[model samples]
Target chain A: MHEMALAEELLKISDEAAASAGAEEVLRVGVGVGWLLQVERQSLAFYLEALRRDYPRLEHAVFELDEEAVRVRCRVCGEETEQAGWGFACGACGDRDVEVVAGDRLEVRDMEVRTDDV
Target chain B: MCETQGEGHQHRHLEVHRHAMEANDQVAARLRRGFAARGILVLNLISAPGSGKTALLERTLEQLRPLRVSVLVGDVETERDAERLRRCGVPVAQIVTAGTCHLEAGMVESHLAEVDQRELDVLIVENVGNLVCPSGFDLGEDLKVVLVSTTEGEDKPLKYPAIFHRAELALLTKADLAPHLDFDREELLRNIQAVHPGMKVLEVSAKTGLGLDLWLDWIRAKVGEKQSLHV
Candidate 1:
């Protein structure tokens, strides 16, 4: 439900970046989704495709998704490891006091654009 | 044809590096600044449905009767919670999210405009009962309070670690029922500590008024802290 809104934001940002760069069209946009955000990638992609139809400049654009991993540091053993799921227990010492390091970011990493000089 | 077309057009890779939630975060930051300037302490309460959030708040409001406090209730669709809070004699506003599972900063910012910020010491935003989506969205509150009940089992903090990790304080509601149920206190506390090592936990039974004083005192301390900063 909210993914559509998020997807719209991504497109708006991409469009603005493209326009500022004097690009004729966006070729591809890279998005990084954090594990904690729980955004549905497929739904976001679908919405991106449907909304792009309204913009001729984005008709040829592709939305790429990159899922980030949850990394944590154990408070007991001081071990840092990537969590496979929501379990925050340390893999080595089985300590529950593991601090989350990353994977809580949602950002547009980069974009490829084509200039009007064609 | 590919080589000819590639030679004719200029393709460039641009670094756009922007947060996807930038729009919401910006509004949330603005609201935080606005609250600080007004010396208002805002708290966003989040929990799973039936985790006793509204009930706890109702009791809390009654316990802190003399305090100037207001509430903003968020629900999928209902004025029931708002009406219930109104009985406590505080100005309450109901924000119907329509179908959204969580309350975003924009919603809070808009509803906040209707309330006179200068008149209140505390503004409580009861988020739409959800642990997942609400944890990811910042509502510009000074603190995020997560509630879990004894009946929900001790593993709840482990099951929904995201909410636990994001919360500054975890309130173990329905503490009166702990004796009747097989709720493992040590296990639950350990789980919460695991997710947030330094997160503060409070046990209170809104029904029995047990531990209610501590809760009220905490609120007062926080309010005083916020006021002193502006002074």
Candidate 2:
């Protein structure tokens, strides 16, 4: 459902970056998906492939996506958990007061472009 | 030919760090600024479908006397919700998202133009009935209130932690039916606290009028707090 919309956004961003750089071809685009966003990689990849037909510039671009672990800090015991679970309690003191340190964003991190000056 | 062609191209790497949700967040920030300038308090209500979001709002309009409030209702495809709220004698607008699961900030910014912002003290947005998709979006609301019905089970918050984690307050609607169903609220409270950690909970029945005063008082206090900031 919304995965298509998110995939379109990622494709648009990746293609636009390559287009603005005046690259003749795009090789790879790296993306980071946070745990909280609940975006499935399989659906996202499928949508990207299905939507990229419109963006000919990215016809063969490699969309490299990786997940970012949810990191949180416990308010009571001062311990940080790199991959927080659904329970959302402190890993140390069992306190529920935790603040998210990362894993709250989906971003296009980098891209590799090629210029064929023929 | 491969060697010659490969040599003709130059490979370059670009470091482009940009959030995919930046566009929606930008529009939300704009809406936040506009609401603040007008001294308006906006609340976005998120809940599962049929969890009584509209019913609670209907009661809100009926009970919160003298507070000028407007509603922006989001649904998949219907004008019926807006029509229902309009009967309460308040300006109501429907955001028909077609097939979209959630309402975006840009959609809200555009649809809200139809209503007069200057005349509003509070604007309640009943988000599309969804516990999942709506949590990822920000519609410039002063706070997000999540509604969970007693029938939904004790681990509703545990199952959908994202929405609960993001919400400021949780409303246990359909409270009048709790006893018959043998719903254990203590377990529900523990599950909610497990994820949200001290999030305020209110039990109310739109039909029976239980705990409506507490709900209204919370709104009144929030409205007063927002007004004092602009003053």
Candidate 3:
């Protein structure tokens, strides 16, 4: 699955960040998956854990993933709201002329790590 | 017992952006800049396995005369699609992912040598026959077009919104077989709008040469837009 690729990227990116920050051990990682893209959280979590052992600094790392909900701005009604999980339409008006203002982002948000000294 | 929260072992938290797509996105952006600077219009074509992407591409290559077009196609294995496209008398390259589901930007970047950007007006990438994974990754194309065959159900757009949402245009292929089948054209258009409102759709059949002129015009317009930017 593509989750494997995403997980590998997370480790590589996190490892680089950890190394640059002089982190001795990566304690936690944060990843944000967009709802529109449809990346499964459990599958991503599994791969992140499965691949952590490869990166020495991330051997003890735990991942925290957040799903960014899709938000749309309606053109006809000028209403903005979160999509109701499936087929998208204006929540206020029944118009389909809406623009996606948020969501569809697949990214690593922030991470926490342990350094060599306090 | 330890005196503190690990007495001498220090801890720190950093708000960093090591996104899952950071590396890929960076590569894609660079590729996009290169293509734009060279005055090239790159279109990434994505669809299901039997959606006739190669057939449509063959028709396009044949009809887009004097356009100086090149192609880069991807599949899990084999150079078959590349061979089929080569018959159209244009430069073509086949990228074998060796079991990967989709093509990444780095994979495409490595194949840049296959085509001479200086002599090319447009570059078409035939993505691996998949709807989901390919839509998730970006390859720095100016536009992403999804092809849907008439044999498939009309709800394809609603079923796979990721790619539909990513695409600015939709191609309903195999229009010649429409009368023989029970497919509702209006329903399909409605479904496409449900996911992507106001998306330009063209009903084309590569086999029967239906609506090829309209499709070609769309391509010409896109290429012209890019060339104008360079001037």
Candidate 4:
């Protein structure tokens, strides 16, 4: 539900960009999701499609999702490691007090718009 | 002339990279800012069904009544938790998910609009009683309390370590029934500590009022911390 709201905002941004650039149609929307967020891409896309249908300008909007893996910085050894699960321990020093430096992100990376005027 | 026009035509493609959830994060950040501005501490409670989350809140409400606290509960089916919390004489609202497994930032954002954040000191969101899914979503809360009762066995933290490890506090509820059941308190504590070492553990029997004061003190301190942050 929260992601749906975010997708709506992204769509609004895309719409504004299209209008500003004087584009007739928005072709694609590229997104980046962090591993820590663990969002359901399909569900977000489904909601986006439903929302886009309401806007004829985005009738043919395409969604592209890219995910980043979880990465943590070890507090004890100062070594950074990529984690697969919730295990935040550092592989080098076996430190459990590692801080997550990245991989909990949800952002709009890019979009594709057709600037051609019909 | 048609062949010349076709040869002269060029296609243009614009690359725009944007995050799909940026809008949701903006709203979530606004909620966090709202809570911070009002000096309110928000806690997201996650647990399995029948994990005694409401019972725990009912008991906690009684304990925190002197402090004047409020709650916002989330459930999929009924308003039973809100009804139960009303008896505590605090402002309570129930959010029914209808079919969702967890509560999201947007839901909390909408509920915040309905409730007056200035009137209450603490806002506890009892997330839709699912440990796995709720752990993945952020409701712009300050703390996450994961409750596991003795009847549920000690292996719960080990099995669902994602919620347990992410939780700032691990509450061992229903300690009064520990003796009646074969539930091992030490083993449970060990399991929780294994995942979250030095984690704040509170053993309370919301029914017996045992260790209720300790839990109340913790809540008071957290409220105080939030208040002091504003000051």
Candidate 5:
């Protein structure tokens, strides 16, 4: 799908989620994305501005992305460590068979809505 | 909450915790929904310059020609990639970022308006050839494929683990030149696996047509899955 279309979908989902939650206005939308997605923030912001023009309800809506870091869990010493850069060696055990428990996430964690109307 | 003022003037205190990229996130969410509705499986390809990303795309477009796939390529300047892809007869759009390091959701959205989304099976966004900054933004792709050419060395995965860890699939390109270079496939694979366990790794040679079938099959399956989801 095109980037604009994807942005529209995300906005729609957020709108639905916010409306269902009875939000008067969504002030903040927290999103979690893993390091692997390679998203261009400025481009996405430009698209969101376009979407906001159409959806007046989302005019004040803010999109916050919580970038999940690349984390590796050691198999030898059972130590979990975030990659200092891109190297995946465990900080404790220096194990190469370290498992990635999180980081590849793309979801709306929470939305801060004005509850004054409620 | 108590409000205080220096001059004893009553003023409403505003607690503002606004995100820097809130607007972009909203647009990305919109883009995601658009793909879901049309059943389009979008993949953003990121890699370093001279990493054979376009060469891989040329081979991919040729193989997927029968399927009628389309491409949206991003470059800092020049229609070179778009022109090269147009030779294959697929609907191609060149997103010239001018001076930008990466392609954003808004840029992709604007280019998308030029083409009919319903006609496309798979839409591949070849992002500007960069590893670091590209990994920080979302273009609303369903999957992110990070390509690392063999000549770039096996340590690339360890150096740029963010792209590797975020990638659903990693493509090790330029397999044909691996023999002439000091590139170790096992070490590269091991390094990638260390960051992304259970991640799909496919080695391909655009020059030799090696491992193209496996890559094509994987893409076909993804498109098929999207079709099923739409149904």
Candidate 6:
């Protein structure tokens, strides 16, 4: 649902970053999505691919997603564990009071740009 | 084709950081800072459409009429909720998101400017009734209060754990109907606990005023805490 908006932002960033770097064309964009965000990767890719058609420089550019797992640290045992979906219980100590340490990140990590200059 | 030693048509990977929700989160952070400066405590209320959010707000507003309080109601369509809150004799703003399911931080920040800061002690944002999308968004509120009624079943916490997990307070609304319905009170609390350990839970009935005092006291305490920080 909100993936369309996110995809739009991703394309805008790619175009701006490419232009600023003196690149004639964008090759690829790397996007990082944490497990916490409920983004459909397929839908995001579809939207990015479909929307990039409007940008000439991004015609061949593709957006790639690298999703990170949700990680939490148990408050009682101080053990960090990867959470599966909504489960936050610590595997070792079985403590429910786990604090989320990682995940929930949705950002553009890097982009590959090609310049026409020789 | 001769390639220069330092310069040529080469592929380069540049670190371009563009946060997906950076736009929204930035605005929310700004709003948080602004509220902190003004010594105002903001609360974002999220729940299903019929989870008694409006009812609880109405009751809370009426009881807190002596104090300065305002509300911003978010809906897909209609000024109905805003109009109802106006009867409480407090500043009320209606944010119609058209077809948008959730209210973003930009929306809250823009509408908040319309509110009179001098007369407002606390701001309560009633998010568009949904359990999923709103959980991911930060609306510059001091607390994210999630409401779930007994009729919705205890499994709601398990079904939509994200909302409960992110919420600072989980409110069980419509306790007046608990007698007529076979709503497992203990199970619901347990489910909420499982999702978010140490999260605060309160049972409030707008009709019966059950736990209204405690809710108001909590708000007062929050307001006092905010004001104390300013001092």
Candidate 5 segments exceeding 4 Å error? A1-118, B7-15
Query: Each candidate's fnat, in order?
Result: 0.71, 0.77, 0.76, 0.40, 0.07, 0.66
Candidate 6 structure quality by residue, lDDT tens digits, A22-56:
88888788888887877778988988988888778
Model 2 chain B: weakest 10-residue lDDT segment is B1-10
lDDT of 4 by residue, A1-118 (tens): 4456556766787787667667667667677777666567787787788788666667887777778887889988899999876546887888788988877666666656655433
Q: Which candidate wins on DockQ?
A: 2
Q: Report the lDDT of model 1 for residue A23.
A: 81
Docking class of 5: incorrect
Q: What is the TM-score of chain B in candidate 3?
A: 0.96
Residue pairs clashing, model 1: A96-B194
DockQ for all models, in order? 0.53, 0.70, 0.64, 0.36, 0.09, 0.61
Complex DockQ, candidate 1: 0.53
Docking class of 1: medium
* Candidate 5 per-residue lDDT over residues A11-38, each given as its tens digit: 7766766566555566677766655444
The TM-score values for the models, in the order shown, are 0.86, 0.93, 0.91, 0.78, 0.69, 0.90
Off by over 4 Å in 2: A73-81, A87-98, B1-5
For model 4 the TM-score comes to 0.78
Better of 2 and 4 by TM-score: 2
User: Higher-TM-score candidate among 2 and 6?
Assistant: 2
- RMSD, every candidate, angstroms: 3.8, 3.0, 3.0, 4.8, 8.4, 3.2
User: Over the stretch B1-231, how does candidate 3's per-residue lDDT look in tens digits?
Assistant: 011245667667777755578788999999999999999999999999989999999999999998999999999999999999999999999999999889999999999899988999999999999988899888999999999999998999888888998898999999999999999999999999877778899999999999999999999999999999999
Ranked candidates (TM-score, high to low): 2, 3, 6, 1, 4, 5
User: Is candidate 3 or 6 superior in lDDT?
Assistant: 3
For candidate 6, write residues B27-102 as lDDT tens digits. Answer: 9999899888889889999999899999899889988867799899999999999999999888999999998888
lDDT of 3 at B121: 97
What does candidate 2's lDDT look like per residue over A1-118, in tens digits? 6677788888888888888888777788999999888888899899999999999888889999899988889988899887557656667777777888778888899988887776
The 10-residue segment of model 1 chain A with minimum total lDDT is A83-92
